[model samples]
Target: MADTPPPAMPTLADLQHWTWLLGRAQQMMIEQGFDAMRARDPVLPAIPGLTDPETLARTRDFWTDSLTLWQRLLIPQAEPVVETPAQARDKRFKDPRWRENPLFDWIRQSYFLFSDQMLAQVEAVQGVDDKQREQMRFAARGFLDAVSPSNFPATNPEVLEKTLETGGQNLLKGLQNMLADLAKGQLTHTDSTAFEVGRNLAMTPGKVVHRTDLYELIQYAPATENVLATPLVIFPPWINRFYILDLTPEKSFIRWAVEQGITVFLVSWRSADASMKDVVWDDYIAAQIEAIELIRAGLDVPAVHTIGYCVAGTTLAATLAILAARGEADTVKSATFFTAQVDFKNAGELLHFVADDQLALLKTLTTDGFLDGRYMASVFNQLRGRDLIWNYVTNNYLLGKDYAPFDLLHWNGDTTNLPATWHLRYLLDLYRDNLLVEPGALSALGVPIDLGRVETPAYIQAGREDHIAPPESVWVMTRHFKGETRFVLAGSGHIAGVVNPPSAGKYQYWRNADSVSSLAEFIAGAVETKGSWWPDWIAWLRDHGAETVAATGPRQPGEGSLPVLDDAPGRYVRAR
Candidate 1:
């Protein structure tokens, strides 16, 4: 047995295999080095001699002329300049006594000596005899000089002006904050009112009579109080907190919808955690079903209208398809999506960060335990770094300007962590693999997601200038959905696109009067309306709203056997 174990010695073939492996490893190392170098600083200069091959060979030969002399004799004789004991002692360290220690002295000396020895091995690429060396030196100097701190735009007058502009913006932000605080202080008048508002905002105002592992619903007594004819269920993406639609009175979309004689229930998706990791597309659909069941049971309603935004829009679409496949069409009557993508074939360039390598890194991070909220925020920040991050940084940090606290910015910074399991599945399945678009590429709860089966009328809205989710990305849904769909191209970016109030200044939106028009032809003939699109959207949604009915009974404090698990506006804000 011992003789047999020692039988495999390194033959020429084995040696060759080792050589190949070493070469491959070296190549990968070189590639990685190149990546780091390019990322750090990329410099390209005109090489007059290298412009032509004939001259390039001559230039190369000239530079290497001193190679033999330098490499064989001068290089071998090169010695490091040593520091005296006094000089070494003068070097600052928190633990000065350690410098006198033998180990520390030897380690520092060895490091310098080793660095000098390594430096001596390379023959200088410049030479005295080389006429082309002059150009090479010029280019090298230009490149090196360009990277120096002095070369930065801080020294330039125009750059100084831009810097001042950045400073002014920050000051403006600070002033804005002061005003907001003053306004809030004046409006509140008392801590009691402020507390009430904060308490209202911190928790959901509705109660969850029905519950699932993923989502819950807060049901309110029908404000219409008539026999409830239609039940409306609002679906919002969990990417942000669920309170955007329920912000407060006047601006609160949910409040407005309820006040307009509609029986509305908003879906409160629980923030993901380890337990919810494996939750995929199917779980969301099931949650929607459960939510609808609970809503119907409480309201004693027949069907429900669904409104979904961003990720939840697609989720609702999938739910509609799932219900249709199960022949449960009576559950949902109409659907609306705001800035959600169903077709992602041309989702755009920002998705490059979510490509294989980055996705793999992200998935690996999530695998540990939780998807760091700040990490996800940083990735999102990169999509519009120039506008969202750098512009502010240059103004607030570099320009030494005071910044006002913006409510939106404060809210934006309040990112939520993703459950690692769901995040990985989301990136791999929806983004990189684009399972949503590919036929049978992805499934939820063992059910295939076929957009063609979504026959419910859809009202889709998208922003024209949204770098995060471009208008072209939204159009992808039109190509796939087999429904009577109206796609509206709205003005502004993702946030402004969705929250564009009627009073928003100088708003513009495009609408295709005929919902059946192909996206291409619709783009050709779409009419642009001045002012905010919210008025038109609200009017359109109103027409589709559930008809008036008799008043429903009061929301029972403890309906059936389920008591209110938590107060309205539960601990969602505390998440992450």
Candidate 2:
């Protein structure tokens, strides 16, 4: 009756991210001004006896280089700056206006030159620390991205076309969409409820056999009459719902595994909310262990084929490594990780923002105990701003079109909160410190965690084009493990690479036929496979897991001391 009391305004935590970003841009402007003040044209001193040929030569060289750079940047038919692999993939730059036109090309090239020259100017600062320089560079890039021609109406031919066709109606709709999303405190591009989770995405057949405060255990129904004696348990990243691995019956890796005669049990994490503010890193590990123990107690299984995806894979490695250190090595029969990295030496540019300054600013807001999920999304979208942020800007606003209903994007849009304490730990220990990979350098649950001490055979799968977990970063983990590691390089980006099903008959993968002496060498000599790597993983599991017996009545899901908690895709998943 009271219009729901005019829904409460978002808190300071929700508002701090924009403040931090704007502050970064402001910092960049101040540094630019300082750099400009310090910069001076090459000054030539008068020589007494003889002409100073060296100084003259230095000035001459600078003039020559500057002229060449300017000529190439300004000439319509001038040479173009080469694009990076990711940049070459952007369709917006492929437009004739951007590439073929002289003026547009010059504008684009001049922007690149300006960005590079500014960064060089920052480096030329005598008293600045490397951290400060890095921040300045990051901020400059963000500013350049914000002012990209594609982001505005006058320069974007597509926007002009739409405006002309619709007589400005499209702009009106887009403005309304923007306002609605702003009110909801979301950066959403589509109606999230366009497709229900259980009905369209996480539709795999399963039941919630057990749950703890941190996670829900879903045991899938066995599809084959004779299932492997060893069960397959997955630890998916708590950053998102577990349905990523079980999107639909046809595309689901879990469903595929079940049909292959393997008992699949998944660890579905609870969506972190205000109530979960007190949840800490140790609390999460204990909760997962408790759920696994409940399953073991109920089914009386001796060993499990443990798998981890993304951050969950990182946590799984740490948790299992700790248990193995405590002399429980036999608990896990084998280990498999998908795009998960423990050694962060070569982890992607996401770490660029994990420095003390940035984290300190972020922690100010996290005192409430959980980073707002929307805020996290805003920060991460910057890493691939063109695709994740601006692509939607063009489609949702300029064209006045709703984002197409995609399972992966849908799940991505349905983001959930991250427990602040756990998130901070992950960022520092794994991303910044690189302690997890160092033998004896890190300890968990009071036990030393050394992946080198882990002899459990591991299967590592990496996305060849993964921006988050570069394949090299994931491949480097092989050196840490003492056991034989089979590494597969799948084609595609992070999410699409892992979710690839064999039926799709798209995207090729490569296998290092020989041992891993070096990632580059292995890549050069790697044998290409035509289809999905799912079959390769399943075969490896079958060979490495405990001996299989005719699955007569292996415990179905929802058995054990606890009654069935609920059906698959439980309440925790639908929380958002």
Candidate 3:
């Protein structure tokens, strides 16, 4: 018998044409599914302006834009017939092919036009409350972002080109990567193998001086000849690993603080599991108090300077309030808050997930005693879906590209679960009820906590672009405090803004000497200083009462009254 004829390999044009058809089919199915869902249960509930004349006008405008876009596509105009307000700045359409190729250009423009109209409609709905409006906007954006042409294999020019170049091998590899990520139960944002907790990432030299079921305290070996008489303790957010502040030598805030004649201690909160199901807010507060007492006893210091980031900062405020109730506010000589919000009135996008209905749903899901860290991580990723979620979806799943080693992303992906009791109380008290700002409205460790009575000198830093904790929200914290407060605004988002080191010289920070009633007022009067805010913060610490003393060595296990457990970036932080 004659040998079977070999199959012909598809050409680039053939593949492109077929893929375009496939992409259109996929898009049509998606649209049909969305329409059906909307029909069954509308995306937005009945609000005052939803079906009013203004909504009718918006519908007309949307149709007008759609018709104009179709006309432009047929006529091949040099200029776009319709434009979105965000079209110029949208990074998703940055590829030249998105503009040069007529089909892709139309797709990109049409997507933006629809997205803009949907968002505008959401905004125009007048009767809905702020929270509802925000929820609608967030949902609209999420759907629009998910359907962006750049995310699909067939529509994305870069992905298509890569597929053609590799003769479908890219798609095969991408499938494999997707499967691996699915197995892991979370998306891979960076090369996980490139970094390790103790090796390259959290390499700051220290020893775990104290350990509890709640946390491990790491006392860093002094880096200077003379260290501050008053030690500094850092309470990083337990939502993620504590290594964010100790990523690498260049980026490690712990190392930098130790080098600057400050004895540094950091709390690495244990990642909650089913075993920690009953851990509540008071337990965390107690843990912080315990750490403070341990530091005082170990270092022989009367009081310690304390720093807290994110949720930890909120807890620290509560702890301070409790201490004030006990007449022990002086235990913390100075308090520094990094992107922490004591007031959630304008807490930003995070509030979207803390709505009453959402909380009820979350409670049901956390019947296992805790909310999985991956769930929280996914929530955060969805907040910046275009970058953190879809961007990786395209690179790792569509284009079959490997992620570059990003210490920040690696740390971000290393999440920690929230104990069910602690999680619900936090969301209810701080986010849903906004009770933290109300004097004696909240209590912890059996004390009626009032932030107003906590007179500890405070240094509060807020990120200008922090979506998690808006600058306004952080600014409102100053109003709750009775003591002298200095508010400094940093240049970037939550992580970069707080983790910024002086050596990198990346982003700028703003500082104002005079107190301001609002964030806007602070910005108007503030001076824009180049470089990181770390030095300015250090200087503030020194002024707050940090006297120099002989630097001490790392207190190994059994060497002191506060027994050391293991090493820096201890087991609590290393737990999965």
Candidate maximizing TM-score: 3
lDDT per model, in order? 0.60, 0.76, 0.85
RMSDs, each prediction?
A: 20.1, 12.5, 7.6
Superior candidate under lDDT, 1 versus 3: 3
User: Lowest summed-lDDT stretch of 10 residues in model 2?
Assistant: 48-57
* Local accuracy of candidate 3 as per-residue lDDT tens digits, 430-494: 89889988887877777888888879999999998998998889988899999989999999989
Write candidate 2's Cα lDDT for 1-576 as tens digits.
556567688654444444445555665665455445446523544352222444334434433444444455444344545666755565656676666665466555555555555555555555577666766767776776777777787777667778999999989988987788789777775567776778888887888877667788888877777788888888888888788888766788888888889888888888787678777666756665665666666667866788889888887777777777878777788889999998897787777878888899879877777887787777767877767788777778777887676777777777878988778878898799999988888776677778877888899999999988999899987888888789999999788899999999979899977875889988999999987999999999988864665644435665455468799877789886
Q: Which portions of model 1 miss their true places by more than 4 Å?
A: 1-205, 220-228, 248-250, 503-506, 515-520, 554-563
Clashes per candidate, residues 3 or more apart or on different chains: 12, 0, 0
Whichever of 1 and 2 has more lDDT, that candidate is 2
Report the lDDT of model 2 for residue 454: 82
TM-score of 2: 0.82
In model 2, which runs have C-alpha deviations exceeding 4 angstroms? 1-89, 95-140, 550-554, 559-562
Flag regions of model 3 displaced more than 4 Å.
Answer: 1-53, 81-85, 553-559
